[model samples]
Target: MKESVSYAPSRADFTGSPAVAASSASDGPSVKSLVAVTLGNGLEIYDFAVYSFFSVIIGHLFFPASNDYVSLLLAVATFGVGFIMRPLGSMVLGNYADRHGRKAAMTLIMGLMSLGVLMVAFAPTYKDVGIFAPIVLIAGRLLQGFSAGGEVGAATTWLMEAGGHSRRGVRVSWQMTSQGGAALLGAAMGAGLSHLLSDQQLYDWGWRVPFIFGLLIMPVGLYIRRQLPETHSTTAASTVANPALTLWREHRRALVLGILLVMKGTTTFYIIVYYMPAYMVNTLHMPASISYWISLTAALLTLLIPFWGGRLADRLPKRKPILIGCAIVSFLLIWPIFATILYGVPLGYTIALIAVDQILANISAVAMFLLVLETFPKAVRACGMAMVYAVGVSLFGGFAQFNVTWLLKVTNAPMAPAWYLMFCSVVSLAALVAWRERHHDE
Candidate 1:
């Protein structure tokens, strides 16, 4: 394993001359640049997770339905609305990144994302603004959806391109790592605030605090991104005319498989990580603070597992790890784990079950991301990735929470989430098999 690990060659190693190497070393991607490229993704996911975490309170303020369940459903539905705009954002901004540059598209995306955060953070409540309150919230989510549509493709492609082929898995894993970090941070904030504030206080104004914090850091993300060196060169971009059309005509099979691949990861992610807090509080009748802390712990584990998985990918056949991981999740983990949680176990037991599930799920997730990155050509990589990601996440991920909630309600079954996870795992595994054969032929 140690022998297989590849490091990026330094300027000194490449140049042979000491003085030239010293001067050129500063030109490569610095630690600051890597952080800058990933910062927007981290912050974008933080905003989205925070909204989900506080959905119960947000429903009261924005939707205000007579029945609490209806209000909560409406809030989650609005959250899904943001995903609907992601495909459009992918087409518009993803094409711009492919044709113009990743840096330019990223900058514009952050600006639009910040505007959406501001609207959500300070929008008038339903009581104060009547029907317009929900309208404003929807507009904000649409803007965010648009921004997020392009974020994954641009950021991941830039990281892979900048790191070169040797450590592509390590580089691409950082995108998901950043998202895990955001989930951790959001969970921590919710935990801390829930401890400090009363239910009335949390519902009234505490829910807005996380969004406000996100808004404050928006400028810093923008400044950092501005300093990033362009990974795709001008000459290469000029050679590709109509990259989107080319992707559609030439890479249609890759696109379909990409969507299926993304479905398992995104659905599992939303249910285990994003929806855990709600599941604990609403279903298990756990305290809000305790639920947040459990989620926070699982999130911390999620952040660490991907890097380990990426290292394994660099050392082994990527497809094998993905298949093994998916098998564990679908066959071994899902039903028994959810049953353990539903049977009213100790808090420690519940946390352990969740942590194990997340670790297995993330291992496959990092491998899938690296596979997608390798599947597309560099010229249209960003657009192709964005389109597939946006479409898959919109269709499955956007409705993940809503579907779970609805299923639980209709069936009155604690194991409903497990069934959903099982179905996604099967679909994704089939997609992985298809991609492996197709890639072999190519």
Candidate 2:
């Protein structure tokens, strides 16, 4: 089941072989690799998070409707439209990475993402352009979704390969950290804008600022990514014409398990990290400013806490037990936690409760991530990871906000999120128990 030879050669191995040392040196310094991956991935996630953070205003501007609920629903639905392109992107771009090189795919992804960001940044309003505004906005989201589809796979694969097996845990952990950092930055901007701008101002022009800022930063990320040395070994031989085909034929079980494993993390992450602020404003009737601040706190926790999760993952002998523990505890606690929030808890208590959910989420997410990486050999790493992640995220994470919004609106149930998370936990735990770990750090 293993590839003929390992794709990730250690630093020592690189230095010991003259040709390899020369090639590895060409790959750029380790610090540069880290920087490039972090910057590119962070920007993609930042743009995505910014859109979610400002979805309400975006709904008003581009998805204008008579009813506020309908408008917001349309906006979030467009957000979901982005997910429609994720699987295609994963197959195309991921196959390219598997064949060509991670560096090339990373560079290409940056260009695609930058274009998407630009579309969203200067998109005209529905009032100004009539029906064309939503069309343009939806196009931008689709492009962004496509670019993001390949981004995580290429970036995480590069990190794991560049850092070697001994350092895989911390390096791969950076992928989650970058996402958290992006969300943190987005939350801060959201809070700052809500504090400074009036509702009318935010509705008119303020929502576009983050996308514009992301566009401006794109060139710098593109430049850094271009400088990265190729991580996929050129000497490795594979006659498989299509990485996706190889994956489906040889690794179908891993693919299924990976998707199921990612479901819990992706669903919980979108709900808490992206959807919570809106939930506070619309459902709990909290002030927009307070909601953004609360979101800021959650983002900060997400950015800082996952490193601990990564380190713990590195130290653990088995990922399954702890992962199961996290899921079980989550299933048990989610209902009561939501009940407490619905009962009008104090601000501090609410923040604490959200923090609890995040901690469990971060730990289990990191553990599952490493487990998935090890489930496949390097031959199909990029496409394998990309396909599963894209499918899982598209199915669960993409429409999570829309679903919860619809659930709460239709059922008049305050605990809709809790119900959703509990169900995800059960599914994830079942997948974890069925997963057979076939590889480990060598």
Give the per-residue Cα lDDT of candidate 1 at 384. Answer: 85
Best by TM-score: 2
Question: For residues 1-442, could you state the per-residue lDDT of candidate 2 as single tens digits?
Answer: 4322223434633343222332344333465456567676688778777776788888988888899989887987887887899999999988888887888889999999988889889999999999999999999989988988888788888876775444455566667777778888876787688789998888878888888887888888789888887777644584246889998998898898889888888888788777876787888887876666556666677677766675566566566777888888777777866776678777777777778877887777777777776776766788888888999999988877778888888899888888888888888788888898766222
Candidate 2 residue 260 C-alpha distance from true site, Å = 1.1
Q: C-alpha displacement of 210 in model 1, angstroms?
A: 1.3
Off by over 4 Å in 2: 1-32, 198-204, 234-236, 286-294, 409-411, 440-442
The TM-scores of all predictions, comma-separated, are: 0.86, 0.87
lDDT, candidate 1, 1-442, per-residue tens: 1123345555434553222432354433555666667777798778877787788888888998789999988998888888899999888888888888888878888899999988989988999999999999999989989999998888887877775444455566677778888988886787689889999999888989999998998888788888777877547635377777888899889898889888877897778777866787888787876676666766787777776666556555445556556555555677776777678677787678777777777777777776776677777888888888889998888888888989999999878888988898888778777774222101
220 Cα displacement, candidate 1 (Å): 1.2
Whole-model alpha-carbon lDDT for candidate 1: 0.76
